[model samples]
Target: MAYHADIIVDENGKTKCGLCKVFIKDSDIYIEDHLKDTEHSDMYLQRLMIQNNIVINGKKISCLLCNQVSDVAEVLHHIDSSSHKGKMSSVKKIIEKDGGLLVLPEDITTVGSKVNCLVCDGWVEFNQEAVKTHIESAKHRRARAIVVQPLNAIFSVEGSSEDLWCKICQVYFENYIEVIFEHVDEDPIHLKNIGKLNLLIKDQNIDIEKYLHDPKEDKALCKRCGIEVPCNIDNLDRHIRGKQHLKNKK
Candidate 1:
């Protein structure tokens, strides 16, 4: 497919997070100190299991990431998609777990047990202070609504309450939504196009387009050293993590 350079870059660089339910990349998402000794985060994932709207601690507010809601902000995300590699068992563990969306205190939602990042395949410490850095990483941060189905359940959610379902295809889904406004997906472009903006302010430049990958797939080009080799998605993904990119990432 002949796509715009920008779109190709966007698709290759960014993705939606099933957990946070937002569009972001490996560097955008992170863990936070909001729902530490609580189950708000985990329960939120649970409600998404089969039910459309959930009653949290007796307080019910429609989710922003569920696509069932029109206002994109109202939709919440699963957080595990970008983390877990098409792993349902891992996704299930996170869904049944608990905590909040970065900030889960005593008002917007409930809190109790803590849920771990699906990518790490581990749990966060009960203390809020504990894993603050982990919460700050791109792994736990970027969240967006997505198109997906529940893994294993006795019953299935249908119609209005359901996001997207295909009876003919024999597929049912909770209907993940897509985040409307995403900056991270456009970050690399902004960083490169506009006169390479942050070089002086942020203090570094490592030939970003070198990591620019083909969006049709996650393929990338090496424009830095001027030699074009195999800079596939995974390679480009790891390329940004080296001391090179991190040195300038503020």
Candidate 2:
């Protein structure tokens, strides 16, 4: 029996229902009858429920998307506002590009401040920036790539040696240097040995000329610690920071 004022708009000397997009005659009876029609009423209610993310309870209308509560009379203006539309757009994008990474709640209509992550198996804040941070995290990347992508995809092969050796995993592929590709791709142990010999060459702290022993095998010798360190960020960092190595360096 009641309708929002904005639902009726005057366009070029014609009165039309903005929600239903139907022209109304210039009489109170005609406008009232059109607003009371079953089709128009159903469409208006459905739009508020779905598109506007509103929950109707008695006289109170709650906007789940924007976390706002408004009177039924003000529902149209609240939903039509720019702020509510922007929130809807952000939520839509998060759902569209989820890629099986997020575990949307069963009651999507009542989604709260957080959502579960399928990859990391943990709760993440329900927002674009929070979801992005979780997806880009190392823990999430490792979990997602456990079966599909190789963890060492960032590692690069060095030189064109006939005998290929993985300095990270310490595995030699002998004359079958090309087989190293398959080894890197399928080897589960490669995840634990997060090293790329090629990356160590660029480090100023690692005196490549002095500390490096076997370039062909990608081995680095810590003269202070008297130990062979794998040519990777993890191993080199640990060796460099060791108490004995620091003591001997001085």
Candidate 3:
């Protein structure tokens, strides 16, 4: 077995970092500083690859939770976790078989691993590229747009503060917001006002229309485009199935 550098310390010590924080170390820093930030530790899982001589090089794997790998994570319908024994082990096996790692980002608080994303629910990996496609994907907008109520209440119309949870691909994140929403700001997104609570989406099916409504009726605005598209589901339907929307549908 290759001893990865991250394994130098078990997951116990790894909890030192928070999912939102970033940590970079100079070679001069002590081992104590390794967990100082959550950046690399989250999306880029660093492990020590040890050789026979006990020397180890730091190896990196794209976060399996980030959804870069082609894996499908499904929530078992109506099975209570209380009755399951070591359930995570089974989930890990399924993900491994798909060449990806399936995991619950919500589990990070206790397990000591930081999730790369919270908004995307773990679909878009922690990179600029995957994020670009995910948000741009119609699926992301539809799921997240419903979240706009919680989002708008907590964030600006521009949606500066939001955490997207995508159960479909199972990645949680910030960048996915930019990918799904149009015209990200020239600034980073923030969720400073949001409490340490998460809202779970219950729909197993992807229904964009159910949540979509005429903004005019509610006097609302689009998080993207910043223009007031018709707030009604009918108008939004036209917008969604329109030329640009259809292109993204593909």
Candidate 4:
């Protein structure tokens, strides 16, 4: 596993190196001293590769939990570890499969802009070129089909709004809000009509700020633009569809 290195300041104002997990008095030469430490340098490079999602030579995959690169055989063992599976299950509920696409629920705690592939459960590079390469991959296409087939089945089932089955929860919602917000965020098929959720929120006299402030309410952050959207799914989709988030990815 890759080591975590964060520069921390102690109560006495000493700088603590994350990887070394030790304190040194803050001084003009602190940075220089740390860089010269062999242990620090090795840990720093491993952390850098983790941050950039780079696999070292001969590595086949990176673990989703710790960002540790591993070979094909070792990767399987790492993924099966208790710690790894626990982390994977936490976000698995928020991942949905669409046609050749895996949609993730918006995460408020993410440090910076990122795009993650739910199928491989890995982070894809943020640039256009890297995103393009991932979308064209055969593995991604197969996983997407596994999710799309079932979603499309229930999507068109004829029933009363209350009787409609939620693909995520696999049960009927008591109201439209439950359908729009609760299940939609976890189901890719429901995301296609997110505008309906917005309008319902407005009609119910809810505010975007209220939603953001309250964890219980649906978030207003757009999955594509990372901005607030209008009250209708059609309008929201129109705004995001042409943008980089929904770009000719299919």
Candidate 5:
């Protein structure tokens, strides 16, 4: 599939993370911080699992939520405990009814320039097409309606409540993000794009600049290099402390 020029494919075919453009990877310092943290780290790992079909040796891969080493297969199940599921359900209802999409904490949603729907925990660039597609998604559409079928409250809607009997009818989910994340992380088709993006960025491809720049947003851009910093705060700190910045000071 032809993607934006920011993605570069190599002979060896091992894809890089920066190419995904879901997260930024301009600075090595930022990359390091990304590897350590939870949110982006989860996104990265999930992308890999879904895109690459990676069979994670869970013993080796630290749990994204708790930082504990768990069996790879059980990791998602472990993280999607009852409390987490309840919170997600509650947040979904709140987003649908109140329209205040604060399902996740402020820090998690505010990291990037894109408008993120915390209900789906997904993001897209700030454009009409992107926003339209996102809002129209099945997940978003399902989230738009807040309905709970009581055990005794029977209606004409045949399968509105009994998801237990029919898996396909299951609308209310528990840790849907975690499941999707794992699947996407293992998908090779997606990984190929990520790999491509990483190569182009590393080679200083100008085409990828669109993903990096957001003129209207101030916090999204870097204060030091005057360039966009896509990664987290630790990376920005490291960038400020780097030899390049140090030399400029002298």
Candidate 6:
């Protein structure tokens, strides 16, 4: 076979196709047979498109899977990179399961320049780079695992309900949405467990008078240390074991 730039004939007489990452028998007949395979033909067309810069600007090529941009000279390396291959595999799985990729996943929403992640209750830039960065972030992954995944499984198993559950606190609340919101908002233990609450509560929806009259009362005052700590099991344990509190005890 006439060796192209992408096809290499090693010293061992093995013919390798860089794009397909396959080794064909050293004979010209075997090489030609492999190149005629439908899969290899598709890959060859892709290589041509990349070489001609039909996917993006002439200087750079944008990956169809992950939207990563690379110089024309480095396009092959980018395509073979772990990140790009992983994204391609993931998208292929989604397409196989869903029958198509026309619809965005439920957790993601794009609005102009902003992309909202329902799982994390946060917005990122709409570009693929920013969206990918946000999806791979620790906070977003944690939220998806702890909140979205569990909720989805529960809903699928038991059917949807208005009841609220806090996985961090391991507590389930009745359908009183406002009460659940207040429970999560005022409970220092819940706040500590979640680090920060991502739920958005409007000022008008909050009962200001109720909070004013019924302020948080479960607080432990350490007279020796002159500090007040939340009256939760974890907070009390931390406070008693703290160096300042130990020094004050002496």
What total of clashing residue pairs does each candidate reach? 41, 0, 35, 3, 26, 0
lDDT (Cα, tens digit) per residue for candidate 2, span 140-213: 65665442222333223376445544444656664342354356545567644443444543332444442222
Which tens-of-lDDT digit does each residue in 135-233 have in candidate 4? 657776556534443432233235554444443234554534334334544655455543455454443323455342332333345533455555344
Count of clashing pairs, candidate 4: 3
Q: Against the unseen true structure, what C-alpha lDDT does each candidate score? A: 0.33, 0.60, 0.33, 0.49, 0.41, 0.51
lDDT-better candidate, 5 vs 6: 6
Q: Poorest 10 consecutive residues of model 6 by lDDT? A: 200-209
lDDT tens digits, residue span 55-96, model 6 = 556888766546567887776677567886676566435333
- List per-candidate RMSD values in Å: 21.8, 19.4, 19.8, 15.0, 22.1, 18.3
* lDDT for position 124 in model 3: 36
Superposed model 3: Cα runs more than 4 Å off: 1-120, 154-250
- lDDT measured at residue 241 in model 1 versus the true structure, 0 to 100: 57
As for TM-score, the candidate ahead, 2 or 6, is 2
Which lDDT tens digits does candidate 1 get at residues 110-139? 243344455454555423234455555554
List pairs with backbone clashes in candidate 4. Answer: 6-18, 195-232, 195-233
**Residue ranges of candidate 4 with Cα displaced over 4 Å:** 1-6, 57-250
Checking candidate 2 for backbone clashes, the offending pairs are none
In angstroms, give how far residue 108 of model 6 lies from its true place: 22
lDDT of 3 at 87: 38
Question: Where is model 2 more than 4 Å wrong at Cα?
Answer: 1-40, 95-250
| Ranking of all predicted structures according to TM-score, beginning with the best and ending with the worst | 2, 4, 6, 3, 5, 1
The TM-scores of all predictions, comma-separated, are 0.17, 0.30, 0.22, 0.29, 0.19, 0.25
* Model 1: residues with Cα > 4 Å off, grouped in runs: 1-112, 136-214, 217-250
| lDDT score of residue 109 within candidate 4 | 36
lDDT of 2 at 193: 49
True-structure lDDT of candidate 2:
0.60
